[model samples]
Target chain A: MGQTTAEKIFAAHLRDEPFPGTKVIDIDRVLCHEITTPVAIADLEARGKDRVFDNTKIKAVIDHVTPAKDSKTALQAKMLRDWAHRHDIKDFFDVGRNGVCHAIFPEKGYIRPGFTVIMGDSHTCTHGAFGAFAAGIGTTDLEVGMLKGVCAFREPKTIRINLNGKLPAGVYAKDAILFVIGQIGVNGATDRVIEFHGSVVEAMSMESRMTLCNMAIEAGGTSGICQPDAVTVDYLWPFISGEFASKKAALTEYGKWCADADAAYEKVLDFDMSQIGPQVTYGYKPDCVKPVAEMVGTPVDQVYIGSCTNGRLEDLRIAAKILKGKKIVDSVRGIVSPATPQVFQDALKEGIIDIFMQAGFCVTNPTCGACLGMSNGVLSDGEVCASTTNRNFAGRMGKGGMVHLMSPATAAATALAGSIALAKP
Target chain B: MKKIFGGPVLCLDRSDINTDEIIPAKYLTEVTKEALKPYILEDLSLDGFDAKGAPLKNAQVIVTRGNFGCGSSREHAPWVFEVNNIHTIIAESYARIFRQNMFNCGMLAIELPKAQIDTLVDMAKGGALVVSVDLPAQRISATADGREESFSFELSPFDKALVEAGGWVEFADARY
Candidate 1:
């Protein structure tokens, strides 16, 4: 029988096709971060599972708490490192090489195209950039994936997001995504694969494409996918050069990466970028976004310009320009976190870090820190903080804290005003 | 294993009520099942939330709109309902990830009709009302002032077994 792109991918990965509707596909990649794995390992040890099914296939990275910054947090990071070394996990990116779990794994080639990826972190959907089917699993599920290469899953419906026209100046990929979330609301794509196509997406850089797929989980999609185009081939060819060469030699491969034109989808959403503007999430949710011009001076208690979502070099450049020669409002605690140590170094080389520090922004090391309220940057009771992270549920950054998600530019501007401020030209 | 369904539900029609909203993310640090009770629905009170807020109060089941749990993989999402006396949550739809998480933890997430959602919302705005859900009948009978409406849902054998087992822990315990 003919099948959709989703069915084709599933069938290729199916180890035990339990039934027509419910199939158990072999997981291609498994990712675990410091926070979730420690307890999970403890649970496994309790369960008497002495050895993992395959350590090479497992990638554990330390990212949640880093640069230690304090004695307690330093101990946490050390514990995670010790566990990784003890387990013989092949890919362990410590503090220096560590980054947000989703960003680091794909960059390292642990997540490949047309493969099934599962991670303990919720944003595992970020790997869908390479046309992979990735999803977040709980600790129990992670335990299962570690013990066995396959994970039981019910196939989800696919959603086609067609994009056309070039993005307007100042309206970056993050805004386009926030605009999509606003239209669809948070749960619009529940249990579905979101495929981006048409001209606009074709024009995006690989880094920007990663940004787009990274936020798919914000609107509750199972994963976000962009087909393997030239950008994908170029970005992946570096790390997987040998694998790509060998795979190319064999024309007929079981797991080919391409989206069929007539692939079935539960819904199709069209986004015209010419009409979009720089978006800032107003109240709390990612979908609660409006153009930056309309959101300035809304009053905020904090401004955070970082997270896996927008802590890249380009994001810092934008933020630094807004913050240069200016001071963060006394009431607001301004924070800047580079996505990786390399990003931090690059920002320093570009004088972006100097600009940020001069503006009274506290610079944090690469980790999913303040984004999840784990470390020092957490918000206080009823405090409204503008952040560049994905989620904005109440107290996401701390107890009773209010998080307003926004672009890095907007966050920097908000830092200057001690409120939600638009990035003025 | 104990049976948790076949009880009356108190419907909440809010959509996209995220994990943080269900039981503020801070409470998730507790590492124990019993600690989840205090934070459930902490965001819903007419008075702005105090950390000491009681969950679900005297509620049984909750009925809500589409995409009820849409963000974060914090286990607190389902633990909120289980600890707060919410036996089943009937929504028009639910977030895929949250639904799977809830299912794994032994929660009965039933999808019901949207018309009843409006009625439930109206009743909630006025005060409290009773919603009866019968898993065996595959119908939810919503009751208020001599009026009873029945809504239908599709259930798999796995879910039926889960409902019969009361929840995930009990089901696992029974199996082991």
Candidate 2:
């Protein structure tokens, strides 16, 4: 009877009586966003349900299509805002206040270590940096989670992605994740729990760890998590209330929740971080990745830098460093949207904003915008664009548009040159 | 009204074909289903473009490694693949959500044993290989090698009806 990290977290957060691992365990946290919530609200209205299960526990945000570019998006935002007001969802983070859901969540204390957080977006695993069991759900299940504060899930078998040694400089967590995806292919870890550990992980910052966990969905994992430590405590301390004693007690309770030393796992993958380099996805899938040096010489018509995947402040700083003196290629269309207002402000204070503007790029406000093909920087027919955002499915940025997924560094380099570089070295 | 899916298997050897690769995050909009067809298999093909004057045309069956359809719970995923003529998929595994989406959309995701996948990939080197997916028997057979394989699946009443109707949208339309 061995329990894994996720199993332990799930047990701690079980809403009702616990059962065997075979049963579909109901989740504790239910989060939603603009694109997915409107329909859920409509479903709730149709069902004649007036109130949500628990206003305090449930969360909603306006990350998608906010600063509404057009009437449709503005209308969509309004609809989401109105729904949140109507439901009295206390944890709702609206536009101006909202950043990327994954980044802003832990900051606001909506996600605590050892808690189970479920959202309607794929990168819910970003909360896993705090040792929480965070996973994504669909619209219908989101509707159910809104009403019941629970969504059903089975216990996933675990896979240990162990890293050794230090990552090479400029080879960030995004590259590490892309490298793993390249090795395992997409869907390599479906219905599986992914727990990242090792010397490399321990050496990485909490933010970097979040970036890795954020893309666990690409591996078909239910949830991905890193164990909590001092960095986790420091990251979370800002959002807690009451005296330090109360918060420390809660944190201690969380510390005890990590998977016991003898917990079972189905598979283990060991990789040396020293072998990884700056990588980018050449084609539509995140797993369609290659080393930066090897990926050069591909032509590009557009370049974008934004998304929940790599749209953080650090991502912007990295891109800004690359683009400061270099001008965007005249033939290429470059769009830079920050992940959040906080990121946007940080970039502004750091002069990253000026560099981007000087480079002849369009810097849109924070939103899910181009990441989901709704707004800014969509591709025209037969168009090819390199983007920092995750995914490159055709018509993803725009109909008839060809997408190449990459890191902000790669995206910036592509924008400057108007072609995928053969080598940034 | 039991339906049959007949299409040659254009086997894909790689594993873990994520949903983001199936349909990128950018295309989650567009209320209409018809708009998604061109993007099908856009990443896997060499042209580095979606369908429309591409080399690989009318590819029906896809063979891949485990956990096909990972990332983001987008229903539009299976809809795009189903409309694109990807009738049957032989994979070593599948993501839970993506597998459920495929089933709901009436696509047969046959999980073959890994050893058989190797033989199937070899057979597909020259051209398309014919793989028969018998839903009633829950068995997948590769005609080139003449090997029968078993797949683990649980077809809900809703999915069974959709598969019986030939496709999901058709079943959805029929219900209306």
Candidate 3:
């Protein structure tokens, strides 16, 4: 049988066959954040197994509730800080240096093709855009990955999603993914790896690929992956240059991670990108999606553009382009948060921040606060928000607030309209 | 880890019960699992379901529809159920990570087919339902309104090992 991309990665990392269908694979990288790592840390401490397997392989960040919204949150951050310091883990990122874990780790070239990555956060699948096998794990698996550098998984089954045709001008990767999730429903890809292929995926930049893979969990996918190609080599060039003889060499090595032509897939799904338009999620589920035209004029109390999913420079540039000379409506509050300090600085240099501020948006530091209802721009009771974040689970942003997930362009247009609106082509 | 265990069944007849509804993000900062008890399902909103009322008051086992505990990879979702002494969740399906988290905690996340789940839901609605799960037999028996019914489910060998060892921490301790 021809091995799928995920199967090949897993075979390379295989350490044990724990059971008939489960493989214990060695992890290349373990990502951690304040919210989930503390529990694993506490458990490790109680077991007297507090040492990390490999310090250099672990990347820790505190982006969830940056600046410590409360004493409890402060304590959580402090625990992670002390633990990171105790282990002398040099890759730790604190408040100013921190960005969303999914965003910053890849920006640093921490992930590579065919590598296996695990994190306590579900969006760890975002790293799979590099052709790596990355999956979100829980505290127990996180503990094992941190202490032993190995995690168990059921044998992977790949679902090939072919994105053919061209995306419309105003549509973006976020729209493409949302449309996929809509077609597949929320649990459509459960227990399977989604291997994205076809021309549409080939044309996407690394940032857009990350955005698409970031929401794999929303559709219950173990990971969403793209084949490694020139774009992958280009993104890692600066950090990987010295390790490789040339960009061509890097591409040749990484290209080995692509799936075999005859690779067996559980099923194959084809989506025509030209048929998709600006998409928005109504109701609470991520799959409750509709074209922007169907949801037009739905009033929104806030507009947020930031998260591991859509807070990249491309997201900001597109949103800024829509808000350049226009101001958001007075009643609709708008917030823009760049995903990383690097993204923030780059946006600043590109005058994206000024454009957002001039358009009546609150520019905040890089924290994953408002995305999960932690802080920065949480909505009030009965309020509705047009957001670019991944999930739209009920009360996700606030206890009684509603979130309508959309692309950055759509969110910016909604900010100006004070209601759900499609971005103009 | 008892081989046979179950209790009063809590029926939540809905699909896609996400982690946010299982345990909201606001309580995620709290360090201890016990701190998450009061907030369990605090944000869940269904037509006839009450977050603070009787349905969840004594739920030791939960019977729900498909994709239960979807969204977010927070282990806190299962931890809340652990703190509340509610360990078993019967659903048509579960989000991948949440299901793993449940098994890692030495709890049961039983997945039955849609027809089986519909039968169980129907049984629970008839009257108060108490379920007994037998791990060795791989069977669950439901008793309600002087009637008894049974269903069978399968657990992977790895998950069975996780339960037998009393969670991943214990399993890792022995091996690592």
- TM-score winner among the candidates? 3
Candidate 2 contains a number of clashing pairs equal to 8
Error of 1 at A179 (Å): 1.2
CA lDDT, every prediction? 0.72, 0.71, 0.93
lDDT of 3 by residue, B1-176 (tens): 34235899888899989999989999999988888988888888778888787868887899999999888889999999888778898999999999999998899999999998888788888999999989989999999899898999999999889988889878876786
Tell me the TM-score of model 3. Answer: 0.98
- Model 3 C-alpha lDDT per residue in residues A1-425, reported as the tens digit of each score: 78889999999999988789989899999999999999999989988889999999999999999989899999999999999999999999998899999999999999999999999999999999999999999988999999999998899999999999999899889999999999999999987899999899999999999999998889999999999999999999999999999999999999989999989999999999998889999989999999999999999999999999999999999999999999999999999999999999999999999999999999999999999999999889999999999989889999899999999999999999999998887
Residue pairs with backbone overlap in model 2? A186-B16, A187-B16, A296-A421, A296-A422, A372-B26, A373-B26, B12-B63, B15-B65
Q: Relative to the unseen true structure, what is the C-alpha lDDT of residue A162 in candidate 3, on a scale of 0 to 100? A: 97
Residue B171 alpha-carbon offset, candidate 2, angstroms: 22
Better of 2 and 3 by DockQ: 3
C-alpha lDDT of residue A36 in model 2? 59
Span of 10 residues, lowest total lDDT, candidate 1 chain A: A246-255
Q: Report the CAPRI category for model 2.
A: incorrect
Model 3 residue A286 lDDT?
Answer: 93
Model 3: lDDT of residue A257: 91
Model 2, which residues run further than 4 Å from truth? A15-21, A69-75, A241-243, A246-251, A422-425, B1-68, B77-92, B101-176
What residue runs in model 1 are displaced by over 4 Å at the alpha carbon? Answer: A1-5, A67-86, A94-97, A246-255, A321-332, A416-425, B1-3, B6-8, B45-57, B83-85, B118-137, B140-150, B161-176
